[model samples]
Target: MATPPYPPPPPYVPQPPANRLGGKHKTVLGCGGLLFTFVLIGAIGSACSPTGSETTKKVPGPAVTVTVTATATVTPAANAAAGSPKRAQESAPAPAASAEPVTAKARLSNHVGQQLQAAQDAAQAEGFLVLTSHDATGGNRMQVWDRNWKVCSQSPGPGTLDTATTIDFGAVKLEEACP
Candidate 1:
């Protein structure tokens, strides 16, 4: 028996080009790289953002005009008689005297005593109607209450003020309680 005349050459298998990349693999890799870049940029922006001591620009406000107009009006007697403001119908009357403001002076006994009369007088003098007067033991002075009170001046010196008008003189605690 003799060998075949032509020995078959090794099978011719074709190889793909080296530089070619898969379409799906390239798309996925590019997209992943783009997403990573975007995420990195976003993180950097957030970190540098004005998280502390942030400031805002103030927008200019619209211009405004203040136009003042008198609201007073004059009416006839007939209208006033029909239950209008009496001031409109009556002849202009003389200006009434201005009442003086109320004032008061008081002395606390031994820093704690109920000598409220002095306070009352001072309040009357200053044109204030005394409502209630009491000893402010916690405040170490006398406190007088009224509709409106103010201490024009104290007799001795700088004293504690309870209200705009009411004040406390120097406190002197008595050895014995007042009768």
Candidate 2:
């Protein structure tokens, strides 16, 4: 091999102290490390928290009582025999004890501008059954599996004392504007 004209350059060595990080860089690195540690701790704490599947026992509240009174009616034929006390007593039946009311009246809440499932849940929570009506005129077909419909209007507007056990909801697809 032919010898080179110039001698080979000295081996390069990095000066450690020349490129050392400054006070600002150290401060930034420390802050980033602390932030990362806090974030990691927060994530771990969230992971350890109870999820939906975990249930806690609830303490029950005091019981409520309702009183009702029942009245009995006597027919004319039975009353006619009232002249004979024994006969009248035998003919007339004993009055039954009053029972709790068949249905409870609840104030209905307006479900307008709410999602269908949320509306249904709210109604049902107040002891009312939900009856949903879908608007298909907008070219969208309603399906049982789809719950993304929004309620446009509700029957028995908000704060109405509802005697009926069922409440009606008029709903349309989420993409459609309310009527």
Candidate 3:
């Protein structure tokens, strides 16, 4: 038999091109890379997060009457790691028991010209906890951050008073003087 000039056109085969990448493949690959990048960033961020600590004050004991202040720092290897917190415990001497009822009184701290937070801390240290403060300029502003304000004047002045008295402090911003 005589051969045809084009070999019958290789039986008219229809095959797709091998070198070109399709749009669908590109889209799928791009989405997978983006997802991988986001997951890697989240892992790195979680590793750099801060560890935490907590402060606890004064626990009453049955016989010892001990005053304890405990503080602990927590660290997590993974997310909320299963372990005990590192703690520091402190103790103070307790007074002897007595039958007589003791009256409660606190000598007020000289909080004038002092930072509002410091004044509050000092007063609380002296067994006075019922406290209130107001703007001395009649602005009726709230002292959101006590450290930013100063005590211009305090009620009942600085003297020993009953613990029941609600101590009120008149305060102004650190930049302004009392009126």
Candidate 1 achieves a global lDDT of 0.42
Model 2: lDDT equals: 0.64
lDDT of 1 by residue, 1-179 (tens): 98999988999889986967789889999999999999999999878754333222222322223333434443355555666576554754444544454433332212122223444454443333323432223343443332122222233233332234434433222222332
Q: What does the lDDT read for residue 149 in candidate 1?
A: 25
Q: Highest lDDT: which candidate? A: 3
Q: How high is each candidate's TM-score? A: 0.21, 0.46, 0.44
Estimate, for each residue in 73-111, the C-alpha lDDT of model 2 and write its tens digit: 555445555587767667766665556565445666666
lDDT of 3: 0.70
| Backbone clashes, each candidate | 17, 0, 0
lDDT of 3 by residue, 74-133 (tens): 333332233433321112123344445445665675677777777787777767778999
Q: Model 3, stretches more than 4 Å misplaced?
A: 1-102
RMSD of each: 25.1, 14.6, 22.7
| Best-to-worst ranking by lDDT | 3, 2, 1
- TM match of model 2 to true structure: 0.46
Error of 3 at 2 (Å): 35
